[model samples]
Structures are given as structure tokens and as C-alpha cells.
Target: MSPALASALAAELTRRADEDRELMRQAETIPPPDHRRRIAQCHRDNAEALATIVRRHGWPTAALVGAPASTAALMILLHAPDPGFRRDGRDLIAQAVAEGHCPAIHLAYITDHCAVDEGQPQLYGTRIDPKTLRPYPIRQPRDVDERRREVGLGPLQEQLEALGIRV
Candidate 1:
């Protein structure tokens, strides 16, 4: 990546992350139902901004700005309002992984998040149950640990435990 491109990506991603944090904090003061909607709207707006970057420069590869930037970009897109964009983000992440430009962890995140968004059971247990505020059950619960390992993620059960959740 050119210095100009790298500088731009770093600055823009930083701004988005900062704005997202601010909005999430603001949303916390809002009542439920509306609070999540407010937060989701913030994500949608951020994702739209990121979409502009994607349109201008294409997928923000890890080679361009390191894995964290790439991961953050994918994460915003996963929460995008447009299902097509969400699906496209997932596809782009997969291609990036295939080309060795992104980590497989990015793919796993988008996959599981998109599945939950589509009302299917997530494969990696990444989604939370909105009502219970707990990690949602995986489609194949028995093999979730193995699947998580395949993507270099630690055991899902332990992660949930750390979150004050069981199973």
C-alpha cells in the first residue's frame, strides 16, 4: 500500500472506531428496543462510510493496514443495514483469506454473524441471544469447539464463561 492509502485507511478507520464507541456509550443511556436500534443505526452509518472506502479502494486488505483494521472493516459491514452488503463483506473477507491477505478469523466472524442475522444458527457461537443477553447456541453445538479451533479461536465455552454465561 502506498503511504497515502495507508494513511487514509488508518485515519478513517480510527475515526469510525471512535465514533462507534461514542454512539454505543450514548445508546447505553437509551431504553431497550430503542437502544439497540440506536446502536444499530450508528453501525449502519459507519458501515456506509466504510462502504465509500470500499468503493474507492476496494476491500481494505490486512496487507494494507494490518489485521485489526481489516477486522474492524469487516465487523462494521456485518452490521450494515443492507443484507447484500453484509453478504458481500463476508464474501470479500473469504477472498481475502484465500489470497492470504486476511486472517481466517475475519471469515469466521462474518460467517457466524451473518448466519445469526439471517436467523440461522451461527456455526461459531459468535451471536448473542437478544433476549437472554447470552451467547446464542451454535447450529452444531457439539462440534463448536472443533470449529472454533479450525479458525484459531479459543474454546467458545470458555469465552462464554468469561462473559458470565454458561453453556
Candidate 2:
């Protein structure tokens, strides 16, 4: 891991996170369509930057880029519009997790996110419906908590409750 490369990645992650915070702050004041467009643009930009970094550095695991930047890289891929790109990122993270270089919880989030992006029922119930404040469809609802536990995530209902959403 080049120190320069790690520093650059950290800077990019910080900038992106700042932009995300600003977007959230402005969300209520901006027109809905405009807010959405801004968000889409932000995702596109972050995705492209992250894709380039990935092409050069693989998955940017914690060993390579530090934990926060590694997690931020995952987030950039998560918000990307292309389902295939998200799937590919998730696959890379899955491999990293298998090698003990990444957290299983990261894998859990991306796995459920990709499932939701592909219109399939989530395996871990990680993706929630913003409108309803509930998890999106889960493939095996009965086993969700068990699956989440295997990946270091708490129960889905507990997560929802943490968000102040009554389960």
C-alpha cells in the first residue's frame, strides 16, 4: 500500500462524505426532483472515482486503505447506479471478507443491497423501505436474524428500532 495512494483515497472519501452531509442538509429545502438529481450526480461521480481506484488497487481493503476509507469505498460502489458494478464490488468485498481482510458486516450490507438493486428479496434484511420504515422483502424472513448474526449484524428488527422505526 503506497502511502500516497492511501492518502489520496482518504481525501476523496472525506470529500465525498462532506458532500453527502451537505446534500442531506439541503434535502428538505431543495425541490425533490432537484435533490434527487444532485444525489444521482454525486453517486455517479463517486462511483467513477472509486471504479478507477479499484481498477488500479483492487478492493481497497482495510489493509490497503485503512478501515474508514475502505468502508467509504464500499459505500461509493453501493450508491452507484449500475447493478452490475455494485455486484462486482460486492463480489470483491466478499472475496476480501473470506480472506479476513474485510468485515462480514460489510459483506452483509452489500449482499442485501445488491439483492434489492436487482429486485430480489434480500438475504439479510439490510435494505429498508424508506417510505414504510421497514425492511424490504426478505427471502427467508424466519432465518434473517440467524443470517445476520452469522455476518456480525444484529437482528433486523433491532436495527429498525434503533432507527426509531417500530417493528
Candidate 3:
């Protein structure tokens, strides 16, 4: 990634973090139904912003990291341009959630290990496991396995290992 792109990504992540914090703060005072609705809207806006950023950057491979469980799902719903993209993304997210990987930790692994442009962490391949229905870290194979273990993927690990992923 070029210096300019890296700087842009850093700025974007910082902005997103800030927005997430603000959303959480707002959620604290809202009623349950309203809070859920507001949170959903916040997620939609964030995903839309992310989609725009990715599109502006030419649709680089993006990994949705974090434990919200809904992050990846929402991302897919909001950003994927077609039904196929949405289906694929949703399947992967389901696998990840089933395998007990949180979005943030999974995101860290992808960002740290993948060949992402320094400025654009959101433009990366979406790696999802078919059986576990979870997103795997594209960058750190070892960490992915470790995470699988931490999440108690005994049977699932066997299946993935058979596929040569070692998780």
C-alpha cells in the first residue's frame, strides 16, 4: 500500500472507532427497541460508508473484524453489490460465528497478516469457512488455528484440517 493509502485507512479506522464509541454511548440511554433500531441504523451507515470507501478505492479485499457477530452480516447486507456476493459473505460470517471467532480478533488477524494496502485495511479478500460458517484470517494461518482451538472447534477443526487449513 502506498503511504497515502495507509494514511487514509488509518484515518478511516480512527473515525470508525470514534463513531462506534458515540453509538455505544447513545445506545446506553435509549430504550431497548429504539436502541436496537438506532444501533441497526448506525451499522447500516457505517457499512455504507465502508462500501463507499472500498468502492472509491476500487473494491479492494476487505475483512470485517470484530465480535459483534452482526458486523460481517451487516457489512454483507449493506455493501455487497449482488445476491451472490451477499450469499457468499453471509455464509462465511455464519461459519465464523459458529466457530466462535469474534469479529475484532478475526479482523486483527486479517489486517496483520494479509497483503493489504497499508492505507486500506478494508479492501481485502473475504475468507470464510464453509463448515464453521465463520471468517478466517487470511494473513495469519497459525493464529487462525489457535483461534479455532480457543473457540472449541474440536469436530469442526477435524473437518477443516481435512481440507488442509489446519484449523
Give lDDT per model, in order. Answer: 0.80, 0.87, 0.46
Model 1: residues >4 Å from true position, as ranges?
30-41
What lDDT score goes with residue 9 in model 1?
A: 93
lDDT of 1 at 158: 82
Candidate 1 has an lDDT of: 0.80
Off by over 4 Å in 3: 58-147, 150-167
Give per-model TM-scores: 0.87, 0.93, 0.37
Q: After superposition, how far is residue 103 of candidate 1 from its true place, in Å?
A: 1.2
Find the candidate with the highest lDDT and give its number: 2
The better-scoring model by lDDT among 1 and 3 is 1
Clashes of each: 0, 0, 21
Best by TM-score: 2
Candidate 2: segments with Cα more than 4 A from true spot: none
Candidate with the larger TM-score of 2 and 3: 2
lDDT of 2 by residue, 6-122 (tens): 888877876786686688799989999999999999988988888888898888888888888888887787788888899999999999999999989899999999988878999
